[model samples]
Target chain A: MIEEETNSRREFLEKSIVGGLTALSAASLFSSCHGDDVKETGEKVKLLSPDGTIVEVDSAYINTNIPELHLSEHNIREGVPGKKFVMVIDLSRCKNARKCKEGCSKMHFLPKERSYVKVEKMQDSEMAAPYWMPMTCFHCDNPPCTKVCPVDATYKLSDGIVSIDNNRCIGCRFCMVACPYSARIFNWGEELYGLNDAEAKAIPDHDACSSHKLGTVEKCDFCPQMGEKNELPDCVKACPNGVFYFGNEYDDAVTNGDETLQLSELLKTKAAFRYLEELGTKPRVYYLPPVNRLFPFKDSEESKNS
Target chain B: MESDFKKEHEKLLDLTKELMPQKFGRTGVIWVISLVVIIAIGLVAYIHQLSKGLIITDMRDYSSWGIYISNFVFFVAISLVGSLISAILKLTHAGWRTPLTRIAEVIAVSAIAFAGLTIIVDMGRPDRMINLFIHGRIQSPIIWDVLVVTTYLVISTLLLFIPLVPDIALCRETGVNPSFWNKKIFKFLSLNWKGKKSQFFLVHKSIRILAVLIIPVALGIHTVTSWLFATTFRSGWDSTNFGAYFVSGAFMLGAGAVIAAMFLIRRQYKLENHITDAHFDKMGKLLVLLSLVYLYFNINEYLVPAYKMKHGEAEHLNDLFTGHFSLMFWSVQFFGMILPIFVLISKKGRKPLPAFLISIMVIIGAWFKRFLIVTPTLLHPFVPIQNVPDAWKSYNPTWEEWSIAFATLAGACLLMTIFIRVFPIIPIWETAEERGIIVDTHEEK
Candidate 1:
């Protein structure tokens, strides 16, 4: 009755049709794809995994793409797909492994001299217990940084990640002054860390800092490009302890690349919290408490060299 | 002062140069040479910094700003002197300002020029500086600052230059005619200053225009600069008093710098009769007024925060008052604000040398005060300082930053030094006109 339409390789990669992609990830736990579990009809629709691999699946599959993942970089600057992003970091679980810091720095090619995501040692009082707390870009809804930037160098993405367009940064350091979280960093000279050329090849050229010229401000982008590959963020996967759960709140689910959990359920169960909540930053990264310390803080004066 | 004034306008007294717009003698030469050497060191250090990066400076992510910002603020603040002592006094018809006006204008033009350049030095990415214009977001206060500062620079410069046309023309009448290279500049600059009634009217009108234009821009320049910090969400920076604070401090520093420059010009050029002790006393009194106003704002800036001690303000205040930066903060407050105000309040302390020293204190204090304003707040943000290294939590300036900062300071000095050598630091025609000693050959009619 209907003219048989050839399923496209491109359409198969689209989020709406990329379900039943069990060959790629269980991240696609959408129910539409699950209903076909009884019918072993590998109707063979082409698919791409978050890990840079391609696959084929049936046309009736559902999509598991995070809502924020679908928006373009321009759209991200405008804000998340439907709702504003916010996070509450629980003060219990952070021992400052700096996995998030390392992942962000590696992604941004931040100079060795500066750390955009710092793990600050916090002691409420001299008598209070000391904890290693990880700090990051708050991705403020009313970002003080974007407010002070002389040029429109930094902006809020639609996915609620505050990103810097380094090419436009005038390097006034006024943003640095304006930022209470100290998430922004200035490129004082050359891109001394030497951008990883190979990292770009792993994705497209659009994903690398090398394409951008030197002398710009840079910080965490939360690895949104990795989302383009339909994969979890580097920090969420690299933390051997599973300290971070990178996810979308729209679906109320989060995963650490290995274990998946309900976002609201995890926050309620673990007592999650946010940093500088009073400042009204509306940060996007939540934390669990540091009640269980996995490792003793190897504390020494951390100099810029370290 | 009386003896020096007696010999100021006559033949050279031993070492002093008696030439009109005067020649530099040995003291001036050595002074200039020292500034050049200092500037050279700063230049070399800057080159090294350019190669090595801002890593040469101890300023880390925590103390992202350092003396460079403070120094730049100092330059901006001190530049206000050009308007306060020159245009404002002229507008009010204060006759005693004749000797001080040149010094005030020189300080204003020189400091503002350095302010313009020094801001670029504070940039972490100087190479991408054009971004301020290409993608400038009007919503950002920094764009407003860039625009306002640029406008103020143009206005401040014209305020200095327009009034000097007649004096520069008088110099052109002598062997001081610009060389072939400078002739074009001198010719264009002179623009037919034959001292006709019409010419005087036009010049007077232009000067009035610039004087009027400069006042608001001067206030805007410093107020906007203050907004650069106040608009931020930091504890120390989130104060309503900042604009007034900055304006007060700017006028104080500018007045101090003017007094110091005027004293130096009078002493070196043997202009005691021209400059006079009366000029010093008046400047000293005005410096006191500025100092008192600055003190009031400083108290407001400090005491108001201290009294209420808002959630995070305590640590920042303690850091300035009794903690890490207490000593430096107290020193600046004492020397920059308190002592100078006290010194100039007394008649005898307003004497040339005493006032000169007080002015020096004001300049030095105001400079270090900027450092306190920029650094301490950053050191104590809302959250606890952590991560990375202990050094990262604290602040320390590296030698490279110091060298570059000091070099810019010296470069400012050298600019003033060279400027004095070529142009008359005193307004000769205005002084001659005031004395009713016109040299026009057309008087025979």
Candidate 2:
């Protein structure tokens, strides 16, 4: 389900970017490069060209020419349809093999290539043994960020995902401070990413992309865009051992990219937990206990790509 | 020049005009220049902050607010001076506040203006400042701050302006020799006042009404500002004592600023006769009283926490008492609060020069005190600041933040400087009447 959602987001963004460019500019960029019969076969279109004049171009450019825009403009207030998402990371699965971080960073196109997920080494005191705890946005039920926004720019969707309306976000960052989990990161400069200037220029609108701007607030989008691809989330797919499960709460099923299991059975069997449960954040993500270790605790080469 | 054989009174008028805020001479020119330079630097920094994002500041998720907030509180606190001198003194029937009124009024206007501006600078999206109104939520304390501070500024400026009409008329009418622009401005602003009986009655009634109204608004401004923090769930910030604590601290700061202004006008403009050693002595006593009230609140704010030491409050106090913030915390307590009280408690120390120096110390120290109050508690919130780098856990303001904060202060001074150049810093007619010889009730009667 997550992979299916991620794939759809890519397709929707690409369609918009190509459709968003007026016929005039497409003619200039592609007139000499592509064929004329392609231009004649589609709907009559009016577009503003690169030089400020109007021109006509083939509608085929919509599909054959442009790559998909990753940011899809579905009324964000109305969440992704058909699935209510959740994640279960069984801490007992392994040590600090940070493959999850590497995959997340690459997929998100983050700088220093870091994403919302972080691997924190934890110990209660000098005598306690240190453990590696991976962190992600809890995507809370009672989100503090939504409560304080002077403009209702950040909101919680009906599907139980907390989302930000990037275009409307005034960059106040009050939400970041209010969040106890430290789940947000700011884009502090223009993006350095996989796309070329044309692709970057055609990147989805504030409503389109999960990452907004240098002046604005950003964090994880729960790989909702990637979830549409009918594949596991980057982190889940990247973990060599089946430690992460991506699923839908309503569907009652979860998959770790290798095998599928019922969400309730997994939690009941593993005695799953959530971080900082005292705060009443009601996180969508849950974690299973590390009592039965899957791998010996060690800081391995897992974090290399994250 | 030859009209009076009274050397002291004649010398006093010269001193008043000279010290009454003359046109910017060389030192004044340099002073204005520096303030402008600082404001320019701060403006550039703010623009950078807007373009690149708030990440330019050291403020992480943990310590979200920094010096900008503290400076804003300092400005709001200082603005309370208008209410203290203009209303409280009038209510108490103090006969000797005549010459000090203009300085206090100007300080009030300037501080409030900066107070309003500084809050915007702290906002992450100053460009979208209008959103405060468009999407204002009553649940938030920031809206209350916006409403109250603006009301206070308008009332204070009016209180400063309405009383100055007769004085501006006096400067215009008695202009045996006045500068061209001064003569022109005085003529325009005076509204051809004949000092009629009806006019005096109406003016007096209006001034009386404003005096009564401003007292509550003054209290409201600082209290509402305090509520901005107190309304939050943060440990050190959540306190019922916050309102009164803020008001008392404001009174001390405003009094300190007023006395310091009085001393500068007395020495530089040589208004020794008009603003006497006696006035300083009285002001010193007043400062001592205000300091005591503030001290009482300080104990309430700190001692209760130290005693019960609520889990979160305990961590916060450790920072102020002997941890990261110990140096600033102790210095602020001593110079901002304790030492001023000790100095003014003695008769000899209440003399003009010493009192003035102590008041200046109190003002400077109080500014830093505000800085400490805002930044430290936020850094020490209940949660251990984790996951981020070490710098995120600790806060040390970058030079950009410092420069921006200082620039706001300088801008306030520069605004006052321009105002002084345009208007008399003392109410000439009011002071003359207060001294003795009453003007005839009719035009040239």
Candidate 3:
């Protein structure tokens, strides 16, 4: 069922990108050179354009690389339909290895100095036992950040993901102030790592929502692009100890790439609780307490060195 | 009897000459030039900020707001003086404020204008500023702040202009025009105040109505500003007392600003006869009462949080009381609130020079007090500050931020200087009426 949904969504994403590519081709054809009629050659390179057309291209012209689909600016707000995405982090499995953070940063093309997901050493008080808490956007149902945004730039979608439209964002930072979790990070300068021309051009329909810009806020987006490919989020895939589970509540299943579990059964068994529950934020992410932790809490050598 | 009339006419002419807007002397030229240079530099820095983004400032994920916000708060605080002196005083029948009303109103107008500009300066994408109006959500406190601030600015401008019409006419009609530009402005602004009995009645009635209308709007402006922070759930911001606390503190700062402006105008124009020792004494008493009330709110804001010390509140309170912010916290409380109250409470301290000196201290203290209110609270968010660059952990504003903030300050001063250059700082007709000296305008006509 999950595979079928993923394939159909992938087809939908391809159609949108193909529409964008056709517009691109139309512009290029008007300005420069491109053939109007389809032609076949002995090379017969098969090309599956996002538009869902299986066309024959010369071997020299065939570009097999399937770049991430950049949806239309409007569709970025719609999210994946018929989905209520949720994350469950089993605290007992985390030892602050930071593989999850590394994978998340690499996948999101974030600057080295920042991460979408952070592994924090937390102690409720001086007397409480210390534990590693990997934190990111709660994607809260009652997102304080979205509520205070005067421009409606950040919004909670029906599918339980709160996202920002950078083009619409005025960079007032009021959303940052309203958020209790401190999940949002501002792009203070021009994007440090510029995309290569080919890569940039590949995303013909780049939604301003997914694009980061100077003076805008950015945060974890649950790797919605990866989800379209029937893959778990980067953090879920990269966790060496299977600490993170990403799934849809509608599907009633979550997978850590290695193991899949029923969302209700796992929560019932683990007695999962959301962070700062009393704040009434109604977070989409849940946490299992650090009961029977895998490794005794110790300051990691990397954190100490830094 | 003919010789006596000639002497009275000469005396009135001399007084008018002394008070008329004079061309900038060498010192005034230098002051104007310096202000212009500073404003130019600030504009350059702001352009740099626009191109480079807010990353040029030291703000990060942890301390999201820095000096730009604090500078905005200071501007909002100082602007309140217009309402306090003109509206509150006029409503209460304290006619002694007549000389200082224009000065207070000018400060209010200029400060509120810059308050609007400074908030834009703080925005990361000022290009998208139109979104605030177009996509403005009434659910947000920011929308409320925008609405109230714009309302306050409009009302303050009208308040300043309505009272200035008769004075502008006086300047124009009295044959004391220093320049052609002065003549044109006074002629345009005067609205033909013919000194008819009916005109005075109309002017008096309009001023009365506006004075009554401004008080609630003035309160609304600062209350909405406080709501910007108070609506958030951050440990330092989640206070029910914030609205009243902000209002009381703004009143104190506004009074201090008016007192300082009064002293400078008195000395610069040598209008000691018009300003008077009695005016200084009355303002001193008012300052003391305002400072005491603000001090009570200060106690209420800090003491209750300190007592409860809920884990989040405890860390934040400790940071303010005895931790990193202690030095600033103590000094602002002392110099801004406590010292001013102590000095103004005593009879000797109510003298012009001492009162002026104390008022200056209070105003300076109040600026830093705003900084303390904004920056320190932001540093102590619910989540502990960690990860990212070490620079993000503690905020210290960059030179670009300081330049833009200082430029706004210079801009406000320049506005005041230009205002006084064109129009008389003190009301001419109102003062003459109070002293039972009817100016014989028929001779000039």
Candidate 4:
């Protein structure tokens, strides 16, 4: 009986994969010809909402609100369940081109002066090589920032993402002080010039958890919102050199938008290490040390003097 | 010889009449009006801050906390003087502490009140202050501070009020004829004090219990404040010595503030017989002792860390010892600690005028020391600051920040001044008892 159930489930998944692809194509093709003529067919199909409620709707209206459904605030804090997400950055591929920073700023609608992700030009010692280091919130298992928040406004979720609830945050900025990486940035006042309110409201909060109020602290959320739909984070997609790889640790697979690799093999082969590992924060983000350079390190305007 | 004793008895009555809470003269009115104006300006600036957020202040991501925090420390330090003079000195049976106790308690009550207010001013969302109670976790140092500060304030007020009961009765019986409102207040506050044996026993016993209670709570308030910084992994704040360091420094400043208050009260009210040069001499000796203890902690706070020159401590120590903060740092060390210690240590220096000057120096130094403690360490976080505006890399509190911080100081002083105007700066009942006055039962009002 168990074998029979498993066989039926596998067969249903296989059939749905084929049917779903065709449905996607048909929706895309017919969406442009919207005059209510498609509704005259009176054909209804069963569909499941993102929150798992099934409804019988005409096929044309099926995918209209699909984008908005995945970006719910409830799921933003709950995060992508059963998945321990992680990121790895290849230092060799980075040559001081700040596209990742730019992409982060753009996706989060951050002010030019304040970007959640900082690209630091680091040199370990006088004798060591200087390299461009892109630093964002490591989303550590033991996040000191969340530990210090008086209101539990910033919290580490079960699925390996540390996020802030701006609505509940009392703007004490203790988290900013607690962060060793200096990854957190405070919205000091009203950000009037960047994304307007309507534009911000239109973009679902889960995209990067972007809409922030003055006095709240903001940091990179690792784009779990993007992870919900199997899409790469904006920074991973934006990097011209494919410097960032993001994936699920449970699945043991990671991707840099263009290529997917086995997580264990890549980390072991590349000798990847987490930043400030001795601090014992246990950051999910890893880095492949700058060995065998793809391009020579060039000092960008963001790079400060050693 | 018998006539001489009667003359001394008459002199004591005259002292009571003189020490009654008098109406403020023209100069007092001017002083109060100026403080009110300053506070009004601060309120306006705070309104602006509320509308604009904390952006008006120079605090940024790097320098997340600034003068508001330091000002908070200063108020908490000054408030500790109340506990020191009233509770600690009383417990130790120090005779000279009687005249200074009321002044110290007044300072404690006002400074702690403003300390609570100043912290709220520092909070980014004052509106969500209730959340402190709703979601307050015991693990956070902030919750500890709130618990202790509130506890200290209540105890400190009771400490002040319980002793004032007999003084209020004295005011009513001596026919000082205070204002109608003042009379009603004193009448209600006096609690029908006939000064019977049982009442005296109950009041003294309650005071003794509170005095013992306040010592731990006072120590807790400053210790928790130090923990707010020390709990962080930042280099300068990451010290095992911070709690003792803060407590020691607080006692030194508290003593300095009490000396200043004593000098002013003696000079202003002309209470030479009550608050004599001997009082100043004893306080000066106490000041010297506290300063030496604080200076010892200062060495431990800075020198021991500098000796090893660890990776994180190197830059922060360098900044204080020789870098941009060096000028302010050296001045605070010399004027705040060293000069005051030297001046107060000598027999000639312990005179009223000289001791007052040294106490002023110590108080000023203590203020700047708090600023140094809060700002410099924050500028040098564990991670090197990068990719930020030049302004964020450094902090200089703007005019609004300055106005609000100074207003809290002025407000504390204003509260103390009003308190003095309402009640005798010296405890009349204690003073009379010390002078061995006979107590008549059921005295006519």
Best model per lDDT: 4
- DockQ for model 1 equals 0.41
Model 3 reproduces a share of the real contacts of: 0.78
Against the unseen true structure, what C-alpha lDDT does each candidate score? Answer: 0.71, 0.74, 0.81, 0.83
Misplaced by over 4 Å in model 3 are: A1-74, A191-209, A228-230, A301-306, B1-18, B437-445
- Sorted by DockQ (best first), the order is 3, 4, 1, 2
Provide the lDDT at A48 for model 4.
45
**What lDDT does model 2 reach?**
0.74
Backbone steric clashes in candidate 1, count: 29
lDDT of 4 by residue, A1-306 (tens): 636633543443344445543333334333433354444345767754323445454455444543332546346667766578999899989886778888887888776666777778878899988998888789999888888888878888867999887767787777888788888877778743266777666655445654577777788988877886677888888899988999999899999988999999999999999988887889999999999999987776656442
What share of the reference contacts survives in each candidate?
Answer: 0.70, 0.24, 0.78, 0.55
TM-score order of candidates, top first: 4, 3, 1, 2
lDDT of 1: 0.71
Index of the highest-TM-score prediction: 4
List where candidate 2 sits over 4 angstroms from the true fold.
A1-73, A81-89, A125-128, A189-203, A207-210, A224-290, A295-306, B1-30, B40-56, B60-62, B307-316, B378-393, B436-440, B443-445
Q: Provide the TM-score, chain A, model 3.
A: 0.72
| C-alpha RMSD of each candidate structure in angstroms | 7.5, 10.1, 7.5, 6.0
DockQ of each: 0.41, 0.16, 0.50, 0.47
DockQ of candidate 3? 0.50
- What is the lDDT for B92 in model 4? 96
**lDDT, candidate 1, B155-186, per-residue tens:** 87776787678766656655453478456666
